[model samples]
Target: MLLMFLSRFRVLISGLSIALFIVLYGFFSMRYVPLSIPWLRLVDFSFWILSLGSCLAGFLDLYLFWRKSPLISTLLITIIGLSITFFARLLSVFYSLLMTSFSIQILGGSLIDKESFVITTGAVAGSFLILGSTSIHTIYKEPIIFLKSSTLYDLMNTLRNTPIVYGSVRELSNDYYIIH
Candidate 1:
């Protein structure tokens, strides 16, 4: 039952993420204006907006559904999302430096330019958030059954008498024995 619920929730998140991305992309693309600083370019602001929305969705999911400390899980997930963005930016800088030092040439001379850097960073962060929020790690917990005294004794006796058992024993809550 819980698995089914979570599976549906994941699908809902995926749909919402796509919808949000589309809206943000349209808004940013239409209102984009060239700025002096390349880093502040809003041409692809949709990606950043999508990434942030994903992270916020993930945080809310964790905080609401998480069985442990909701606050801690929410905080940790948020921090991890931010850290991913930070790492991606740092890696882009390193990549730029390496490209300048080496003679590696692709379609263009500069690979990790400012525009690509923002796009890549936002994409990575957004992907992480979407995945983390939708994917759940859950421990299977068995339900406990309360059996009457006579039924319990008979069940135990039958098990004790059956010596050569080739299969595992599973007791149903009701008083029915299914033999194969």
Candidate 2:
């Protein structure tokens, strides 16, 4: 079990690290280097990479669900969702900043407006907050039951072997008594 846990932990860490590296590299490359590739293509490729990473993390979460506590599983899912949402939003901000900087370098004035950035960031934050609250509420409201057949049988046996306690009794008459 320990070996299995360590292997899964390594996989999770490596996956997140690779995803972070890709996002950083992509952002820096887009911002600093001038490539002949179209901006739309770059955006599409970045989205695809981000989607793939999210999918991989989701699969890993599902694969290890049974081994983890329900609370931990719920937290992992929530964190993964929030991280992906944050990264995607960050990438959008980085793209916008790069565009604004590039335009300013060429035009001597900022062509990009701040309203769009503000709106986008606000919307992302609002949605993330709503999602997080709902997820946590749902997770706490639901109970986790991981009982196996053998475990159920053992529980029944143990319950059967336990002694039963009787409450105090009240005497009604010589031959009649009531147990409370």
Candidate 3:
């Protein structure tokens, strides 16, 4: 049962793991990176949003995985994850650009300015690293193979055979209408 669940949500699990790693790395590495810009708050906020988006995407993937049709769900989840990653990358790039511009303006393109550019570029690169790792892991993981197991196959068949209906009935003019 545990294996089945893991296989079904492997993509989400792997993606979350990568995101966690990035978050942890950023947390620990922040001490070493100098904060000269006044707008560091904005960068921090963007990073928080990136982390939140990754987590939400993971949950969305899990929700879709349990639905009746998983192939389409998987596709949708993949697209969502990719989109989230892309947005995060863009945010990071924007943050980096701001940092670069600030550094150049204040430092007159000195060694400090170069350092800021490197730091910002590295931050954005880290996001891409997470995306690449998650993509590779998702591509190689065999979630569909789990569906072939006898137990899972039977369970899915049973679920498909069952019909779920929810409705409120209203009577008007000697006729009843069901709204679901």
Candidate 4:
């Protein structure tokens, strides 16, 4: 159910909510205007939306992995999902802190010169950094191989040692090896 929403609606909502939160917080954090409501109130909704999206993504990932691995998929998804949530919260803190710090400058009779390009580029880079780093780490670790047992390793070895693949790969004569 959650995955369905995430795959379809949750992604858009979370992304928009995060963007809205960033804009609103960035606005208030830099200016420190008197609020009729509260300071950074929009952030609460954004955080929840982001958390739900992360869990949905994680659950769907586990479901896909369930075919090959019942245990490892469950564990990795749970752990990584939690970690993503934690990191998102940290980024939110960074956003809030940066805004608040800038607010003092604005209040001190300094003009807030907004650079549209810089914000867009920063957002793109930050998104890439967050997503790219996690993906690269996952690829380097090759966690899927770890989920395999000794039996699977032996089977893979058997396949790799087959004459067709061996001749193509090693370019060795049949007499160089023995088949018992």
| Global lDDT of each candidate | 0.45, 0.41, 0.44, 0.40
- Which is superior by TM-score, 1 or 2? 1
- Tens digits of per-residue lDDT for model 3, 17-41: 5566466546645744544443343
Model 1 worst lDDT run, 10 consecutive residues: 137-146
Better of 1 and 2 by lDDT: 1
TM-score-sorted candidate list, best first: 4, 1, 2, 3
> What TM-score does model 2 achieve against the real structure?
0.31
Candidate 1 lDDT at 102 equals 53
Residues 59-132, candidate 2, lDDT per residue (tens digit)? 33334442343433343444455455555555555555686664432111211334323422332332333244
Tell me which residue pairs clash in candidate 2.
none
Query: TM-score of predicted model 3?
Result: 0.28
Tell me the deviation in Å of residue 18 in model 2: 5.1
lDDT of 4 by residue, 88-141 (tens): 544544454466574432111122122211222233333323233234324443
TM-score of 4: 0.35
lDDT of 1: 0.45
Give me the displacement of residue 159 in model 3, in angstroms.
35
Instruction: Write one digit per residue (lDDT tens) for candidate 1, span 78-118.
Output: 34654565455445445755866755332223234565455
User: 1 or 3, which is superior by lDDT?
Assistant: 1
Task: Evaluate model 1: give its TM-score.
Answer: 0.34
